[model samples]
Target: MQLQVLNSPFSQEQAELLNRILPTLTDQQKLWLSGYLAASQFSGAQAAAPAASQNAGQAVSKDVTIIYGSQSGNSKGLANKAAKTLEGNGYLVTLSSMSDYKPNNLKKVQNLLIVVSTHGEGDPPDNAMTFHEFLHSKRAPKLEGLQFSVLALGDSSYEFFCQTGKQFDDRLEELGGTRLYPRFDCDVDFDEPAAEWLEGVLSSLKDAQGAGAAEAAAAASTLQTIESEYSRTNPFKAEVLDNINLNGRGSNKETHHLELSLEGSGLTFEPGDSLGVYPENDPALVEQLLNELKWSKEDQVTVKQGDVRTLQEALQSYYEITTLTKPLLEKIAPLSTNEGLKELVAQGNGEKLKEYINGRDILDLVRDFGPWGDSAQEFVSILRKIPVRLYSIASSLAANPDEVHLTIGAVRYEANGRERKGVASTYVAERLEPGDHVSVFVQQNENFKLPKNPETPIIMVGPGTGVAPFRSFIQEREETGAEGKSWLFFGDQHFVTDFLYQTEMQKWLKNGALTKLDVAFSRDTEEKVYVQHRMLEQSKELYKWLEEGAVVYICGDEKHMAHDVHNTFIKIIAKEGGLSREKAEEYLAEMQQQKRYQRDVY
Candidate 1:
């Protein structure tokens, strides 16, 4: 339907302009436009009436504050998106990181939106700690006039899925803040739910502030910027240039050093950024699952509303079949005739449910539950899409243009009398080969980045595959001729076979790109000496470096190594600086606020 001057109230040029843009607008855009036009007509009608009636429309607040607490940049990206949306609708938006936002200003905010991702074990992300503390503290003020909404990002696989967001939502309501829209808690697949939350929030805002507030120019500009060549939804397939095992013959571990060619993909990344890989499930596992279910491999299943693939193909590439979640168990329970499966997921069986889900997969569930009662299509319909695995980039773009590198450790373990393999890690280690293509996208992490001043010294503590980003960091410093003094504390099981990138580290040390190196081989020593022990050994010098303003970067196992390393820093600071443990903690927290201490642990 073309807009013409003969039928429409628009001039010939205006009609042509509308016709050109109407076809390009998305369904969401069209909805916004329609609401805006209706509101404008309503406002015009009121403007021509009595002046006394105009006060109510003019009293609506146009200010919105968006704060994000992000660990891997997802929340930050969404926060920025929400800011743009609000701005496009003629609202004055104030977007900030939770660490940077003033808690005292909470009382003044009319409309507030929080986009935060829960970190390890229900804890708030590093950047959100301060704000989270302040909000929950006794000093927190009442927010009677505040209207808020929260979009929480988390993985349902974790025991405390979106716990931090739930805390914020509850706390805000406790302080008398009204919900502009109910909080939305998202699992690993958050894009759709997040978009829905944003739309709902925008609608509520329009209802409250009047939809005539939209700025067409701003909306058009925002729509233009939304176009991207490649993203999480549309990953770029990059060819693998090299794939080699980093461990020697004597090692118990299998770590692959993978180099991918990003030529013509235009996917560039910095040292601190991560590469997200979409990997396929093992064919052997998929075959086993199909055989167990007594389903035909050629059976067609709908992966989504429009996408369809064979049962085998869907299990192999489209859905996540390895890990089992509580939600998955509940969804599949009704389809099963097994009394045991139903009882395990029954109410008041929370502890048992968590125990069962800990080390078991879909295959384990199917085997243990007994005879099933669902078709292949129905089974696959409830499965979540395979989440992309993110590995810290191991090469600098400046040093190796049109290429990206990753250090992936094969995760092979025995649990519940069955051998288990990591989805992406084992895929890279055992299946991927040179010249084979892998779909990838760059995930920017602003929280874990080098200092802007090249001369600032740095201390990096990375154990095992955690050393990946530090490799990129050192390479970047070397390539850019950075004058920063670098110290690296690396640990592994053995010195002989587990010294990953040993030659590269030696070359960088010789060239003075790395100022100091300390390695701890846990098994080689009489006692298990980890990175923390090494740091404690060099406490004096480490304290001196901290005093000299050296930025600290830690990447590795968050459950143990990162936690130990963090405490070790505090111990060193307390012992050397003659401060109490509490004071030392304050010092470390201050460093975090200054962006001198950053972590990229998982």
Candidate 2:
């Protein structure tokens, strides 16, 4: 008898049973199921069964659901890759951003894969908050029959790497869902590890499929479409059109208006998207390091799988020139036995290490270490990679399809009479001259987009350069002729010197494009008022707007401003709206679940 499995036609009750059973599956059982599912896809005539029996009973090949929770685009890329891989193997794949997925649809999942990245301090990515909360809530249904797996990505330097993935694994188990395989927690350099994990997952799932199911998969494989093009590792080189200091010369802080031409690249992005700028090391810093160490500039070095012409070339072309890590300190610590260095690496002194390394560079470390013999390869290997710097796109594709613009704050600070330049920021602001070409890529932000309903009012709270995307939003709204009322709350140090896009904002207000403008110049007043303070002062009106279904958007410093603004909204709901603390909290949470309260805070 030949049994064919095209896609498991799951009944609502069958899905609920699988969800209930998923968390109870043992490790060996998970491995068994994974292998069975994988083999079933290619089992061909060998594992054939009666067609009616196969449809009614056990079946391995099912529609694969790929859901991703991405803060920046890393998880999305991984999810996209996973979908393509399964599609290649003849599996029907449904891919959706977690924020867009209906939370109740988990009850309909027979085979589910979640790819999520943790944000600051173990928080789920902005888009995953709803799904994360729902899974742990009392309202979540028991899932005893579901088979699932999670691949979590995070930065190991953070205490809570892959935290959301862990949460999903635990919660799914608690709800009685079976794990298809052990969850994989990946760190900063996740590509190799992620690929290995993916291979394991696919190999296991391919083994348990019956012959007829296998033939069906083979048929679907030929119909799959996979993307082949430049990605983060290989970005398109874009020529810089202009790089002007937006901040005045006399002002303490330096910021720039960077315009890069993306003509003929076929790259497209929305307003809230970020541009990832790949930067090269500073030549001056490299020369200074060579001089400080008394190392020959002609010394050859190899790193990660490639060789460089010289030590200077290696430093400039590869390796991080700024931001010293604990590993670097550890390498130098033994040589120095300096009390400070020893104390930094000592037991129960994590905070001390953080304080010591916050702003210091490699030069400072070498100066204190008294110079020693370390190969260029060892030095660069121990050092972190030069990560791409992300800047919010300040221009809309609707306005400029052939170019992208950025408002970048040049990071310059003084310490020990030496100037420190932020590796990537300085590279973009000072080193990359106008007309120079630099590699670039787009990072989409689906959570931060304007509401689908154009008439939905938007209240934007972005101080300093956080106001960058709001400009794009206003432009987009103007171009689309949206009837939504736009209100902006922007703050900086001074009105005279710190107000960005002053003329444009004034024009927007004058032309009725912007319904309200609230400016908070923290330094102008002795009392020091910020955007949150302004929000609090206008609690009555703010509450009214919230009541009238205005979508609240906050983007800026996450440490203080975002938190403060969030708390202010909660207070306004409590005090101005006459709700209790818990009720006000519920109201805010409801708004987030409803997607009315959104943030793009960095």
Candidate 3:
């Protein structure tokens, strides 16, 4: 009997190969192949069909709103791009900063998309501070009418990648909002992946809109005036007027007071904003790389972004010259003669890869890789883009209209018997002398602004360089002639050595601009004391201020100091307010929900 031929989408070679192998395959193998084709929709050379739009002709509203919470403006940039893309696709989109968003209006949103970045550890970004708290609170209105999506940007190297997005997703569902699409947790290299996800969302909600066509038409007709040029990707180079050592001579640490000119950029920012500065690698390190790799200093190379003259030039100008990633390790693994590198690559452990590269430079990598030659372009391909560092603006716009100031702690550490430096911090603190140019852009942080009601009491917790923004805050309040009471919690190892901006802080206190002053010199006495301990010391009064509508602010280390201060607040609420531990926890949670408690920890 002749058997009928089963024609499939698979290519002829694949079909023939499969048929030849079928007789020798087991039942498990056949089942696996069946499921693979069902899920993957491809077998060897089979071409897959495109997916149909999920919501075609579903009557989508003309008004689309994008809310973004960003610390360094990366999230906001991405959000703006998404809005622009949607507008180009014939949808009317309004972009709003999360800090400025009114929580009461969340229920009125129909087609909503959020782009938020997580801060240190797992906390929400600074701009999303209040919004995140409100969502988890009882005061938040039900979002049942909202159809939303979230694009959470984070660093996968951290333990909590897209933690803020996960929280938002969970909270929105709890409030009965329908998720239009699944939330995407994007890592550092988020550009391509974000674009892909956005396409999916555009396809899914192509037809979902508000009921009225006239209203949609009116909204859609309002065309967006996009910025013609200039962004983090293409920053304008500004001149550095001065970069002086803020710390007194003989001090162990190197801190700088820097000044840069905006000149003709037309960029203006308020006091609470930060300035993102692009820094080049140290010249000494670049020279070392050239010598070790046996490459000429004038060899030109092209990377993913643009072409640059010389491997040293590329490393200094375009790529991250210090930190190493898993991809870079993988790229060099085959050429590496070191047994440690070989074992690490075989294991595929990201953390171990970091360790292997830690405290080592490109020269070290080349040495370990032996005589295996690598082209400059190939080497540059493995490196990540040079990241911009954020520095809190120390001067208020009212004080310096044409310029910005920064308080930088020069990163100087010893590792492997060689001195190491912070990529951007040292660049600004030591390399860029007075009158040199530094590329910079303002990053607005509205969430960390001074209290709207001047009469409201404000308590600020900042230690080390965390004191940077508080200077601006106090200056703003003073300039506005605010009657609000102000309290500051500052600490360092010793009062004599690390009391940054001490003279200015004391002057403010003496002039009555500061209502209360508290200092926590950790190593002053035999026993160490931190700001949280001081908060505990004044628990009764602190709780009284909380009762009297005082606004509490915290900024500094997120891992330990922030957590310690948080615990201290709970203890105060429990003891001073005379509540149980569980109730105290609930009380603090309620305060967060009410936007009475806020943190700006890094």
Candidate 1 lDDT for residue 592: 99
lDDT of candidate 2 over 1-602, digit per residue (tens): 22223345776667667767777889899998888677656643443553235655776655788899988778998898888777656567899987788878878787789999998889999889878888899999988878788999987556566889999989999998888767999876676667666765665565545334444445434322343344565688999999977675566667788899989878888877888888887888888888886667887777556555677877786667666666567775665546767777888987777676777777777776555445655555566666677788888888777999988887788875688887888887778898799999887777778888999999999998889888888888877888999999999888777788888899989887789999999988989999989888888999989888999888888878998888889899999878998999999988986878878776
Which ten-residue region of model 1 has the weakest summed lDDT?
212-221
Query: Which candidate leads in TM-score?
Result: 1
Q: Ranking under TM-score, best-scoring first?
A: 1, 2, 3
Number of clashing residue pairs, candidate 2: 40
Best by lDDT: 1
Tens-place lDDT digits, model 1, residues 1-602: 87779977899999889889899999999999898777656654543443334566455566899999999988988888788776656667999999899999998999999999999999999999999999999999999999999999999888889999999999999999999999999988887788778877887776664443243333434533563677776799999999999999979999999999999987888889999899999989888888888778999988878898999999999999889899888888888888899999999999999998988888898789853646888878788989989899999999999999999999999999988999999999989999899999998899999999999999999999999999999999999999989999999999999999999999999999999999999999787999999999999999999999999999999999999999999999999999999999999999999999999999
Which stretch of 10 consecutive residues in model 3 shows the poorest summed lDDT?
43-52
* Backbone clash pairs in model 1 (N, Cα, C under 3 Å; residues 3+ apart or in different chains), count: 0
Give lDDT for model 3.
0.75
lDDT of 2: 0.79
TM-score of each: 0.89, 0.82, 0.76
Which regions of candidate 1 fall more than 4 Å away from where they truly are?
A: 1-58, 212-227, 371-373
lDDT (tens digit, per residue) of candidate 3 on 126-224: 668778888899998987778888999987545667899899988888998888778988876676667666765675564342224443333333322
